[model samples]
Target: MMNDVDPQILARYAPRPGRHALLPSLTPQQQVALLCRVLHREGYNDHIAGHITLRQEDGTYLANPWELTWAEVKGSDILRLDAQGKIIEGEWNITPAINLHIDVHSARHDVSVVIHNHSEWGSVWSAVGRVPPIYDQTSALVDTDPVCYDEYRGTVEDSELGRAAADALGEHKWALLANHGVLVVANGIRQAHLRAITLEWRCRMAWRVNLLGGGVPLPAAVAQATGQRTDASGFPFLWEAMARDEIRRDPSVLE
Candidate 1:
């Protein structure tokens, strides 16, 4: 991918230390709005059904309020909710699925962001509990073995069901909610949003491969090595590119 680029030019783009220190400086509202724009750009917007939650330093979280479409989301539209899912600050009520997000966040301290979306290809792939393989470098950004939550207890209105889903997710960064859609969790909103969009793209690729007679899986050793390398350093660049593009397309999201 870096073909023909000068070594000096490539060096300028290399990952630098202290790059992630800026993440914590972002307010919860800014993080939520930026992620919402990223998801919307990736076509993950299922009207107002999808939600992204960013953990706050004060043990609360910021999530998109109900009735606001992803494309319409701005920093002002984000709702601050306590750990119990009660809206502490916002004009609109929380989505019923807030319980699900709350459970996952409570269970996984390592997870600073949770993204749940009924995205098109993600939903189609989840119908059969299929987790996409490491088909390419981009696909390898996700876990080689993503979790598949085979039990769909209607809506995740009950906290118990939410915990069950979190149990199904275990320690994986990606989860295919069987008969529903996909959920991606990560240490930051950028990574979570990047993984969600990557999952959907991987599923689309896998579906096409199945139609044209199944293809051979990458060798286990190669898959594992590629996954490790990509997972370590690929996502930030992808996230930055997408975020910049989204901001250029619609600068109002930052407002």
Candidate 2:
């Protein structure tokens, strides 16, 4: 028998920060490597065109090396760069385009992790010069509709272009990189990883729906409520499950 529920009691059921207790017991380097392998499996691999960076306690950063594809990256291959962007560790080089991460980190103090990839489906949407309307419920996992950097000033090879893209991203956690790819930012590994995967899936589904003559999206109030439920903690349990697949596929990533 259903009865009137107490609002305070109902609030207790909502997602909380420490609710997902199954966190990966790995170092930051190992975590980054595992996420790269997982993202590669999830279609974020695009030769050597993608990058993931984690800002460190000393204000330096740890990023993937440039010579290898995201799939081939391991903990040992991760690089540490000084705040000046010079490689202070690792046997390989970090991409110059990492300036994009630098700029975003500067612009948004809340972001501790930044991921950029020229993924297949995401690239397709990037060419459209605008965000695809959210038609599916899962796409609502994002904080908001991504800001599109439509100026298309070529590759983000310099600080100026990086700043422009970051400016377009503004306060949003996601962005469509004009004629390029996608950018996802968050304060944790789980959030950033999940957002990247969700952003790509959102674009993939949106395009498919558009081809099918399109359908109506969830109402703003409903979608916003859904996002509130899903966005909290970025579904850490899902991250643990997906990360397990990567760990089982190659145990050496923990190196």
Candidate 3:
């Protein structure tokens, strides 16, 4: 499967044909530009608390520079880090969760995008350490069993803790960092963002249901049947497009 690539030591996986390419290869700046749009759109910039990362074809990862508000972030502000969490480019430092992202990406090569955020509903759900399955088409996120829950112990400060959280992911595309926030891992930025959005919505729905005298959880067989669900194109095109439009129209989200 790893063919048609450069002869360099890290050039094992070939870029898919027909996919867009960056002539000079994407710099950390361009990656940050797209990430600013994502962060601004996702409303995860609350006090500068969330991050998004893209694994480049060169085996390095690009992410937002530490300590910058999502809105204030420019394309030139992204930081590129290697597998060992060493910075290769950019001036800002990496966030504590940076190692967590590196760990997950190292363990799951299929996951090219990683997003961590302390979203509203996600934070609420994480505090309790529970995330129920789908109750609607949007909940189809859990359809493929993409959501995982990790109990809160302490802050994720070291590579070991990050690796442990990655293990909790267990092949799922998303996971709730208990008493903390949410993490989304997918093959593309759109897919990862979609998962994060849907996860927040699901958690909100569950929170509401719980408030109104509690709600019944889905049956095991029903959840399993739901998990069998899949998109014909392996993606939810309409939903993704619509969400992007809304985000673009109102980019000053957290402002």
Candidate 4:
């Protein structure tokens, strides 16, 4: 007997592999660099004003250095750093402001990746110092309404500011750094990248709605259901496609 497949189950299942699919073989550096380039094309590049870090099993972090633009990140450019933010590998320096990533890692052991960037639309909402409404269904791909850290304390060069930002983020998957940018934390790189991209999308749409002066909220129950479905995504379909696209554009990114 053939039973109708539950759509929910499908959402939670892995997608069939494409011709170039090879998820598990990718290294931490390669993953982080790929994320940078993917987001870079999405307008997340603000000079060298962003950082993406992946946590290691023993609490060290793999991060992009202060020298390279996200658009030009290659796997070889990733630096390994100790818990105390000391460089353990690679020949480049980390920003003292990396305390933001370090503190978030310290506070959330479940988080595998932390991405912060002064992205275009996200910065527009950040300047407004409020959580933008979830106008598009795609925007709800992120966890609910992102909380706002409606305070700017310069560039987070010290642990104090970083810890404060992490505290503000609480358990939310992403937060808007008012007058600055966005911070996203996820259990894996794929979810983190998706959240970062969707955060920008939501901000962009919200701005359009604001400019036109008409915006309607999705019912709370409907919005919650959408978020649950989006969160249930199991495979790396979005990340895998974006990554492969970047690789096709610049093979050097893998080196």
lDDT of 3 by residue, 45-71 (tens): 566776778888989888887788766
CA RMSD for every model? 5.3, 5.8, 7.7, 4.4
Candidate 2 whole-model C-alpha lDDT, 0 to 1? 0.81
Write down the lDDT of every candidate, Cα atoms only. 0.76, 0.81, 0.65, 0.82
Please provide, for model 2 over 176-237, each residue's C-alpha lDDT reduced to its tens digit, 9 standing for 90 to 100.
88889999898878778778888888888889998999989778887777777666456535
lDDT of 4 at 82: 92
lDDT of 3 at 114: 85
Tens digit per residue, CA lDDT, model 1, 137-235: 566555467789999988676667877887899888888899988888887755676577778878887888888987876666876786665554444
lDDT by residue (1-255, candidate 4, tens digit) is 001223565455545667433343677899899999999888798999879999998879999999899999899999999988789999888888899998888888878889988999999989989788888787777557788998788877767887889999998888999988999898777677778888888888889998999689667777778777666452236666788788889989889
Pairs in clash, predicted candidate 1 = none
State every prediction's TM-score relative to the real structure. Answer: 0.86, 0.89, 0.73, 0.90
Q: Candidate 2 or 4, higher lDDT? A: 4
Lowest-lDDT window of 10 residues in candidate 2?
1-10
- List ranges where model 1 is wrong by over 4 Å: 1-26, 233-236
Measure candidate 3: CA RMSD.
7.7
Cα lDDT, model 1, residue 222? 77
